[model samples]
Target: MNKDIIYKDLDSLLNTLNLIQEEQTVIKRKLSGLLDHVVPNHFIDWAEEIHQQILNREVALQLLRKDIIALKKTIVQKKSIIYFVNNQYVKLIIKYKEQIAYLENEFKLWAKVTAEKFDTIVA
Candidate 1:
């Protein structure tokens, strides 16, 4: 791998990581809003359905977090492989990082929407 290419890829990876972090921040904020609206009175007969939705969201969120961790690991590994030199692998790492961020954001949106629907049903 060319030294110049390695540096360029590293820079691109860093930018992608920053974008992922920004996305994560937005998701956290949305989730927080959903949490704020949770109420016990909303459960009733629909409790079972609401519970299922919550459970599903929990599982999805866990998976998204796991993917984020894996992306971080891949980034670290790619950096090591580059060893301060340019490499072609950086593009693949960036793609995965973007994908992880997208999945995380998608899950967060789903969770938020589910919570809102539950809230409406209970209200």
Candidate 2:
């Protein structure tokens, strides 16, 4: 029963990570397209900054995935399940949630500007 709970929690975390990764991928592509346009220096700088954050987050996600895999192996072997209540794992989930929230707020501004710029070009 405890192992089942741990597996469910791990699955939930993995799903959340995957969703964040997909969103970041979309933002990365949008940033690349924006760079090709005649955007302002500050906008370019901000986009670059966000791009770097996305890259860093990607590394974090990879590491978390590896850890999850290891945890699963331990479960399969009927080893200790202390990893489930690990403070590091909890902290990571909180940190990821905060980062995603920040990115969403920042992306709203980026999207607004990009849409306005695109509209002007079309008109």
Candidate 3:
């Protein structure tokens, strides 16, 4: 892929990840509020569904955390600071960036899966 396209995709992905985090936060808060107020027995099933949604959100957050770690590792490796390090260190840094990018893409796939799960749960 073109470097420019890669960078643009990265930027858009980061923004989407940020929005997902925010939505997860809001869902957690709302779930807590719902739990505080006791509803009729008929609503228990809906509450359980919400609980599952919360769990899915938690899973998404975990995926996001992994992505963040990978992103940080990539950023560190791509920097010029490795020039001062030994040759092996420089090679390791380059390797790290490549590996992290692969892992980041995996996490992104998980994010998409979790998103679909969320939509199904919500629907």
Candidate 4:
């Protein structure tokens, strides 16, 4: 019935489904052997058209793989930035809460350091 509890549950569920790690591994493996699976595009001087097509595809896949690798690097850097931001926010929130609690306590010893008690002199 509490919204905060619901939000926490949803956040946990979303965290379980994070695809960053899995996708990163898959992408690295694919990029590592991107050209390994394809048949060679060497010229045999027999079928020019078919060889040309194969070469064209090889070039396209190579180019696309490079682009994808670059994009992945960018995504990972951005993700790290986001993770850093989230960590800082969490730390700030905890510190702020602690400070508020300290201020709300029954005794404030810190006020003694920054303040002085003055009394009027009876002449």
Candidate 5:
């Protein structure tokens, strides 16, 4: 009975992770749409490029909000997975830890790059 509960809990957590990942994908599309709409004004100067980006500040802010929310969700999900794998998934052992670590590192790197771009745009 306890084993069944563990498996069910793990399964539910994984499903939640998948859903959040899908949400992240949609957020990415939204952010991409906003970026695509931004055309560079090469006729002017670098200052003009910044000005154009400023014109889209409202959309940028929205993207930032969505990005932050997704990021927080991802972090929480990762921590939950880590805790579960450490405590419950004994059969997976080494494989699960390595896979989970890889997933975390990849996500963190992606988030860092995204944040850098966002900071540049907002600044």
Candidate 6:
């Protein structure tokens, strides 16, 4: 793949991540508000832990976004070079992609479980 294309993709990914982070902030606020009214219980504690995990994931994603930005700059400077399979930047990109995928899936599952639990309690 062309370096220019890769840079563009990285920039796009960063934009998407920024949007996701904003959404996550909204979600966290909602969860916090919901937790505030819920009676103390083991399930509530579990939900709080999940919220903490979400915060940790946000921090991790922020760091990853910084790394991606740095990598994009490096890609621009190394325009003449071709990335081989052994390239560190390529490996890092793959790792970030995998992490994003894993986190997204986990978030979806957590949302489903939280909704189900809240439904049972509220109903």
Estimated TM-score for each candidate: 0.37, 0.61, 0.44, 0.28, 0.41, 0.75
- Supply the TM-score for candidate 6: 0.75
Candidate 1 residue-wise lDDT at 107: 52
Ranking by lDDT: 6, 2, 3, 1, 5, 4
lDDT of 6 at 119: 69
What lDDT tens digits, residue by residue, belong to model 2 across residues 71-120?
66666676566764577655654665575566556656655665575455
- Superposing all C-alpha atoms, what RMSD in Å does each candidate have to the true structure? 7.1, 4.9, 7.8, 30.4, 12.7, 2.7
lDDT of 4 by residue, 1-123 (tens): 233433353344333223322333343343234334433443122124433533453454344335434533443455334543465544543443353344324113422321221011111
Best by TM-score: 6
Highest lDDT: which candidate? Answer: 6
Candidate 3 accuracy as lDDT = 0.55
CA lDDT scores, all candidates in order: 0.53, 0.67, 0.55, 0.36, 0.47, 0.74
Q: For candidate 3, lDDT tens digit of each residue in 1-123? A: 233443454455555555655665665565456556746564456667656865765576566556645654564466454432446544543554454455456545755664564455445
Q: In model 1, which runs have C-alpha deviations exceeding 4 angstroms?
A: 1-43, 80-123
Error of 2 at 58 (Å): 1.0
Q: How well is each residue in 1-123 modelled by candidate 5, as lDDT tens digits?
A: 243454554454444445435544654664555466554553234434433543344343344335434533443455354554453344443333354455445545655665565556546
Task: Arrange candidates, best TM-score first.
Answer: 6, 2, 3, 5, 1, 4
Which candidate model has the greater lDDT, 1 or 4? 1
Model 6 spans > 4 angstroms off:
41-44, 81-86
Q: lDDT tens digits, residues 1-123, model 1? A: 554554455455455545545554554554455456654544433445544555565565555456545644555565354442344345555655575567557656865775576457546
Q: Give the winner by lDDT: 2 or 6.
A: 6
lDDT of 6 by residue, 4-120 (tens): 667777877787677668867766776677777776787588777878878887888888888888877777666465552337877888887877777677767866776676667
* Model 5 poorest ten-residue lDDT run: 42-51
**Off by more than 4 A, model 5:** 12-16, 40-89
User: Local error of candidate 1 at 35, Å?
Assistant: 16
Quote the positional error of residue 3 for candidate 5 in Å.
1.9
